[model samples]
Target: MAEREYTAVVYSTTSGRVIYDLDLADDPEWSARINDVGGGRITVPLQGGAGTTRVREWCVPLRYSLGVLLGDHVCQAGPIVPYAPATDKRLLTVGFKGFWELLNRRVLHNKAWNPASAKITDPSADIAITDSLPNIARAIVDHGTTWQNRPGSFLPLDLPAVLPGTGTNVRNYPGYETASVGQRLQEITQVDSGPDVLFQPYLTTSGGFRYIRHRMLIGNPLLVQLGGALKFDYRSSLVALSIAGDGSNQANTAFVKGSGNEAGTLFGYATDTTLIDAGWPALDMVDASHTSASVQSTLDGWARADVALYGTQPEQWQAVVRADAAPPVGSYSPGHYADYSVKNHHWLPNGLYNYRILGVSRSSGTPRGCVDHQLQAVRTG
Candidate 1:
C-alpha cells in the first residue's frame, strides 16, 4: 500500500496570528516551495535543478485560527438583521396589547405543560369563582372577594373593555380575545396589530397608595411535581379605596385614609409603608420613634400567614425584605440589600434587627412596586 504524502505551509496574518495550511501532500517539490528555504518572496528552482517538475501547495492557516479565536467573542454569526425604530414602536404597541389580552384570558392561571386536570386544581376552582368576566368586574366595583363557582363575573369589567382614548365606561364594553405566545412574540417584533395591543395604564391623582405583595409558594406537593420549590416574582398591588382618617370610610381606612395632608395612616406607621424601612435593622432602629409592638406583631402575623400558605416546612421558612428606595437614614447604597432572615422558624423580634436594608425605588405611579422574592428549599446537595 502506498502512503499518502502532503505538504504543510505556514503564514502570518495582518493581525500577527500564525496560521497553518490545511491541504498538505508529502510531495518533496511542494514541501520545498512552501518552506521557502531561501526566505525569498517567490520560490525559484534550484540552480540547474530540472526546472521545477512538481509544484508544492499548502493551505493557509490564518483563516482557521483567526476564525476560531473570533468565534468566542461574537454573539451571533453572519450578517446582523437591522432593526428600525419604527419597528420597535410597532412591537411595543402590539406587545402591550397582546400582554393584556393574555392576561384577560387568565392564561397565567394554568400551564400548558401540565395536564388539564392537574393544572386546574383546587386553587383553579377558587380562582375560577372570581375568574369569570362578570365576577372580576364586580370585584373591581364592590372591592369584595369573589365567591368560588361564578364564571364571567370578576372585578373591573372595564379593564378588559376600555380602548385607548375612549372615555371610561364601566358598563358598556368591547370584547377582546387573548393571543398565543407566538402571536405575542410576533407583535413584539413586527409593527402590526396582527396579535396584540400596546397600552399603558393611566394613574390619576385621585388614586391612593398602592401596595404590591408578592407571595412565594414553596413545598407544595403539586408544585413539587411540576418542579421542587417554584420561584415566582408574583406581584399584587392594591390601593385604599378611601382617604385615611375619615370616619365615614373606616372600613376602607384599614388600608389608607384622608384626602390630602391630613391623611391618616392605616396598617401601621408611615415608615412601615416604605419598603426600604420594612426590613430588619432599619425597622428596629426606627421602631423607637415610629413603630409600636403592635406593628411588629402585625408583620409577624403576615409572615406566619405567608409561610403557612406557601412554605412546605412552615417552621423552616425565612423572609427576605427588599425595599424600593434609599433608607431614610443608613450607610447602605440605594439598592437591594438583604435585611432579614428567619432561623429555625424563630421570628426575629423588632422584625427589623436581623434583616439588612436593601434600598429600592417605588416612585413609579403603578400600584405594583418593584421587588423580587425567591422561595427556595434548603438544599442538601
Candidate 2:
C-alpha cells in the first residue's frame, strides 16, 4: 500500500473552532451508514508531554468532535466519547460517534404551539400532522433542534427547509411525542419506499465543521447506479470477496400490526408470490408497535416494506478492496448501486451482479492512511 498522511483534528462542536490537532494517530478505523450513526477511533502515543496533557483535557466527550482528514477532505468525523489508555500506559485510544447520535439525546415533542416551558411528558393538545414523509421528518427534526420550541435542544445549523421531490405517501404522526428522535427516525424508515434520514457532516470552505439533515428518498435520481465505468472487479480493486445467503430471517409473508390494543389492533399483511412460487416454505415475520400509524395505507406500506426487505432469502456480500480503487472510497454513499463482478467462483455464477451498498468501514494501513475499505452490500437485482 502507498503511504498517505492522515490528520486527526479535534474541534468544538458548539463553536466549530479548531481545538487541537493530534501530533500522531495510529490504527485509525471508521465506518459510516445512512440508516444510523457512524463512528471511528484512533490511538495516540502518550508521552506525558504538554501536548498529551492538552489532548486529555480538551478531548472531552460531546464537547469536541474528532475529524479524520485525508489531505483537505474530512472522510469521517464525530463527537469524542471514549478516551482510554493502553494497559501498558504508553498509548491512549479515543473513540467517537457520528454527529447524528445527538438525536438520541432528545425526544420528539408535540410542541407545535406550546410554550418553551412545556414538558415532554405532558399530554399534547395539538392534533396529529398529516403530511408527506419528508416534510414530516423535517418537522420532527426542527421541533427537536430548534430553540424556539425548546431552548436546550437548539442546534445552529441549516437543513433543507423544503425537501425536493419528496414522497407523496402522506403519513400520520400521532404517537411521535416521548419517543427518542433517533428511534422515531429509524421507525419511519420501515415503510415501503421510505426516505433515509441522514445526519451528515461537512467541512465548510472556510474550514469550519457543520452538520445537516439530508432526506434521501428511495429510488431518487441522486442515488446513482454504478457499472461499466465504475465497477468492482475481483482481479483489480477488490482484494477479497465473500457472499452469504441467509434464510433464517426470510419471510414469505409479512404482517405489520399498527396502533391499537387487543381486538382493536390495526393489521396489514403482504406476501411475496414469487418466493412462494419458487418453492419457498411458508415463513412469517410480524412487525409490530407502529403506534404512530393511524391510516390503513400506512400500515400496508410498512408490511410491503417488510416483505421487500426481509420476505425472501437475503444475499449479502462482503468485500475487501483498495480504498483508491476505480470509484474510490469516498465517492459513493449508502443506497447507491454498483456492479460487482467475479469471474471464477467455485460455488457461484461467474458474472456481474448488481448490489446495493449498505455500509462501509475503512481502516488505516501500516503506513498510516486509509488504504483498506470493506463494503457490506445486498443484492438488489
**lDDT leader:** 2
Off by over 4 Å in 1: 1-98, 101-138, 141-280, 284-381
Estimate the lDDT of model 2: 0.65
Q: Please, what are the lDDT tens digits per residue for candidate 2 over residues 116-191?
A: 5454444562325555666666666666676444456644345675656545565434333557767666766667
Quick one: best TM-score, which candidate? 2
lDDT of each: 0.21, 0.65
TM per candidate? 0.16, 0.84
Query: Distance (Å) between predicted and true CA of 154, model 1?
Result: 13
